[model samples]
Target: MSGSEQAPVVGVSTYRQRAVTGVWDVEACLTPAPYVEGVTRAGGIAVLLPPQPADAAVAAAVLDRLDGLVLVGGSDVDPALYGAGPHDATDPPQRQRDTWEALLVHEAIARGVPFLGICRGAQVLGVALGGTLHQHVPEVIGHHGHRAGNAVFTPTVVTTVPGTRVADILGDGVTAPCYHHQAIDRVADGLVVGARDDDGLVEAVELPDHPFGVAVQWHPEEDLDDLRLFAALVDASARRRTGAYA
Candidate 1:
């Protein structure tokens, strides 16, 4: 590797440019965009992921250079991706997100690279690995208080399991800001919940044997909570960058 090359490069997901609430309009090198800021504050350079249908090999090559991958939260996944029919709360899902994130997530896991999924990103990682999500958190579960807005933040408590990565990273328990209506339902295969809400919502999950993977249904980049997970991800990624994996 060239000495001038950056250390610990992380690929971040960008929404497709389309209609409102369709695909996320993610631009290039856009730093401090909530989740991207979360990654940056943790000591990793954030690379915005854009949908490029004509460059699979090039994308894979670029992905190969990174030490880790991050799937940021945005639009809801298409109901059809899962085995369920469109529920009453189903919205127009982001197809590009499914395509790009799926490729990146599988590649990252296969390469023993560390990955962290937050909110929709978490659901993406979960569903990509054979899990499910509740169409709407409010429609069934009575858990309320999570509001949707860039300027507003919501609150909820999450109980962490001792000895779990989520617990060790954030310590004991954490209640992060939540804005999503969809959540993990069946719990992805090979993954386990590390935290939960009083209403039984799956707040966080961890991969049993990957380099380092965790998907959370809450948003920890809201500045309301202590950002421990980001630093942990970056540190683990740095280790991976230095051939420190078992």
Candidate 2:
């Protein structure tokens, strides 16, 4: 089969956490089903990358086999990564996952892999690029609208800046499903703001130099009807696989 006819392999980072399931309570590496389904629906094969001992070489070795990478939403990133103390509301640091994903982000960007970040994934991208995060959104925004609680996704209007990859995929405005209590604070030098919420909080970011590096502070997988972001990533992956971007 031709490169274009072959489905691109996209790696989705998994959450390493302790959980109970069918009388087997133990630590597990898992991602929400929607993440896998979204990638598959977008014409790509999804592979889960579970957190383990990771470094630069490890990341490069893993990313070498994939056409694209997806940093799925998950727990809070260790605040120390950006030289800050954790907020009272921040979850305990998942240093293992933090290190793993950060290395992957660097490797993926260095190798020109099509990549997308969602929710916590967005925060990971920001931090990995030397940016800081607003540990608690409510403290900065004076409202809890970003997260309605009870695992519910609040609809927040996000407006994209013109001429950004995010704008190309999501258009000017969209009511994105957001449940994040943290967001990008100081965007790194190389990354540009792609979109923002009505409150002026950074909601998305993009790396202009890369072919496909976009991260949104919303949960797009929750809205099955809107597969624009996933489709865009998969299309980019397909192009990468076919050497179209080369």
Candidate 3:
């Protein structure tokens, strides 16, 4: 390997289609540049996985090739996926993404693949593990300060549980940038809280028994200055590739 060679590759979610307001046909495979750029900056390769045909077999094959999985933040997951009644704020899910990423999360977890999920990614992880969601965190909990409208990408103060995976990586707390209107309500069968807000929302989940699994209700990828997270995931992926993360 050359002096500048990078480590094992990691797969990330892609935005292939989306619903603008009430319209659902405006397709887009969008993603924030920082996801790829940050991974590279941390000496890891980034691979994009579109949200379609993401079957268990396909995911196992991909997991075999890659060392880690990163779930990027975007879109509102269908409230119905978690057995919730119709949400007044429910937006049409990017069906293409819904099926694929959901499958990817299940397959990755089943195969013991190291993984990290951000924002909507965190919500998906919960549902995939047979849990539920509170379609709108503020609507039910009335944690009005959790989300700031108009300029949706405001910051929230998340206090992590001491000794949890997140606090161990990002210190005892961090002010993460959030844009999502939905959050995990049911604590999932295989996941546990790594942090929470004053409102008692599940701000993060960690698979304490899995090789490496963690999810956060914020856009950690958007903050390039937070290389601790980027480095942690890359390090986990490298361990997975070397068969040391088991």
User: By TM-score, is 2 or 3 better?
Assistant: 2
What are the runs in model 1 whose C-alpha is more than 4 Å off?
A: 1-6, 18-32, 54-59, 148-151
Give every collision pair in model 1: 15-24
* Tens-place lDDT digits, model 3, residues 1-246: 752353868898888765464656676666778888767777788888877665679877878888888888877887667777767877777666777888888888888888889888898899888888887777877665655777567687889998878889988888888777788987888687999976778889999987779899977776788877778888888888777855
The lDDT per prediction is 0.77, 0.94, 0.80
Q: Write the per-residue lDDT of candidate 1 for residues 134-199, one digit (tens) a residue.
A: 988887676546655564657788899888888888887876887888888898778878898778
* Superposition error at 227 for model 3 (Å): 1.6
Any runs in candidate 2 off by more than 4 Å, and if so which? 2-5
Full-model lDDT, candidate 3: 0.80
TM-score, cand. 1:
0.87
| Of 1 and 3, the candidate ranking higher by lDDT | 3
Arranged by TM-score, best first: 2, 3, 1
- The clash numbers for all candidates, in the given order, read 1, 0, 3
The per-residue C-alpha lDDT of model 1 at residue 86 equals 73
Models 1 onward score TM values of 0.87, 0.98, 0.90
lDDT for 201 in candidate 1 is 82
Ten residues in sequence with the least summed lDDT for candidate 2 = 1-10
Q: Give the winner by lDDT: 1 or 2.
A: 2
